[model samples]
Target chain A: MPAGEICIIVPCYNEQENIKNVIDDIIDNTPSKEKWTVLVVNDCSIDSTGFEANSTGKADVLDLPCNLGIGGAVQAGLKYAARYNYDYAVKFDGDGQHLAKNIETFIQELKSDKADVVVGSRFCTKHNGFKSTFMRQVGIKYFQWLIKLLTGKTFTDSTSGFRAYNKKALKFMSKHYPAFDYPEPEEIILLNKNKFRIMEIPCEMRKRQGGVSCLSSNRAVYYMIKVSFAILMAAARKPEE
Target chain B: MSAIQIISITGSLFFILAIIQAIRLKRLKEAYALLWLITGFIFLVISCWQGAIDIIADLFGIVYAPAILFLFMLVSAIIVLFQYSIILSKQNDQIKNLTQELALLKNKAQGCSKDLPNKES
Candidate 1:
């Protein structure tokens, strides 16, 4: 096959304050002129996230009629990538935590033909960026332990949303990804069951440029328990193949 | 009539009338209306023939029969709720798909409207 299309999927929910800068950053940092398309999924924001995204005209805005959470928003973008038959689909947060500068690294890594899904990890290297608070770090470690116990594979930063997916991964997620809550850790179990390869690339993550994170201190605990059950349920069932 | 009898009779009649009204006004789909009708019919029969509850409860080896009647009603309600949960899950999947499709179509249309592909130099 020849060179393929790369679609950077930005799932936005009330990120009007940071969305324009996010789009501009991606456009400024991308190496290719027309190969990469910034597809932003505005998740029915009550604010002007949709308007800001559309006004920039640099990204293709997919305005959802109803809010479907992060999974639905991201999956909507994935479905678009699958429909248009893009070779690579990358998920970047709309709150500006994810930097566009590392996208070239992701593309280069995907080109290396190693992992079907490439996770941009904040804990992969000593020179990491903004490694959250102490409690959040402990929560990350707990998930790391749980994943190792269940799948016998170690994954740091299981909840990080900055990641890249090739066509095969994008297609799979477009059809069967969970549409309710956070799907990062759940996706690991799914990929493990289905026998897909995942690789991690070191990424520099920053604090959010604007808006509040969905996971609070209290909500983080609930997130861990909920994701644990979801992982267990997924692992308990046999793979469809 | 006893207090329990009056309550059961009134409850069952209310359910039946509610189902009928919902179907008549097109508030409930015919398929779903059938489920409500079945529940109301079961309640009506149990209220009218109280001995039937004893026989069924005795068959299940429970000494307290009326307790079983309430338990049965609870189970039926739970099953209906489970059915609705399944329906909601399916509808959720469909809505996600439709939203994704609509977004893609809208984007493509915008692109086309901006510049007709064939007209490009």
Candidate 2:
């Protein structure tokens, strides 16, 4: 792939109702580039997500045989992009939380060589729409503090899945991404350890267009414990020079 | 032997036995087993000759004997974490490379389909 080629990766579990609309929005928003492509990694979706994604001419459907969690699914997409030699890769949420309009900003940042990874942060700037619940806000803040302590960088929205990565970042993440849920914090630490530059771009997120969030009240506690342990373990380890 | 010596010897023997069992069951890898074995031997030696450890601890500028043990535990944890990170990063690289190769092969196969005959029945 050339220097400016970008691939958008969307990981879907059971977004049958929203998959088609998401794909259409992505297609409508993507600029005319010879090498730009959309890769929808279907994480063994029991719904018609795979069928709907295949129907969309804009995306390349990569269906996993078994359900890997969101982390695994995103890793799969990164692997595809890296293997294809794309210059940049962006991860977009399958549930429509990420807006297609913000993709241009990500591309512009990458093109200008501002940072290796550009993250779309909801809390970085004031927006009138879609405030996360108070509990969720607290959870995000705790993770953000942990990330800052571990990585020495303050990230406003550590859990936001909307982000773009340059080729080197893509290669690094593809090689060493977390396998379970809530990989964002761990990935940020890993990237920082490797001396990768990460920048936050302000973007608005919409409510989900389809199925409910995978993170329930019970799962939130589990996520906190697991992520905290993972971060501590990661912090203890020495990074390769 | 005095009562204190007898109790220390018995405790050291029990610790050594547990370490051996762990090694046998493969719960402890060889590198880790070496550390455990060394620590167990040190305990066994101290239990047999407490005066020797006292002299060494004094020479090392250590007042409390347990401080050495705590230091060893902290160092071992750090080493284990370092080794684990190496393994995890290597595994991640392999997974990424494999997935990328699979995607490329799929893309190549799709491209080749156009060159083949339409039907071969």
Each prediction's whole-model lDDT (CA): 0.84, 0.79
Q: Identify the candidate with maximal DockQ.
A: 1
Which regions of candidate 2 are displaced past 4 Å? A1-4, B1-121
Model 1, B23-86: lDDT tens digits are 8999988876777788899999988888898899879998888888779779888888888998
**Model 2, span A28-136: residue lDDT tens:** 7877653577778888789889878876655677777667688888988888778778888999999988998789889889879999999999988886376788999
Residue A15 displacement in candidate 1 (angstroms): 1.5
Location of the lowest summed lDDT over 10 successive residues in candidate 2 chain A = A1-10
Give fnat (model 1): 0.33
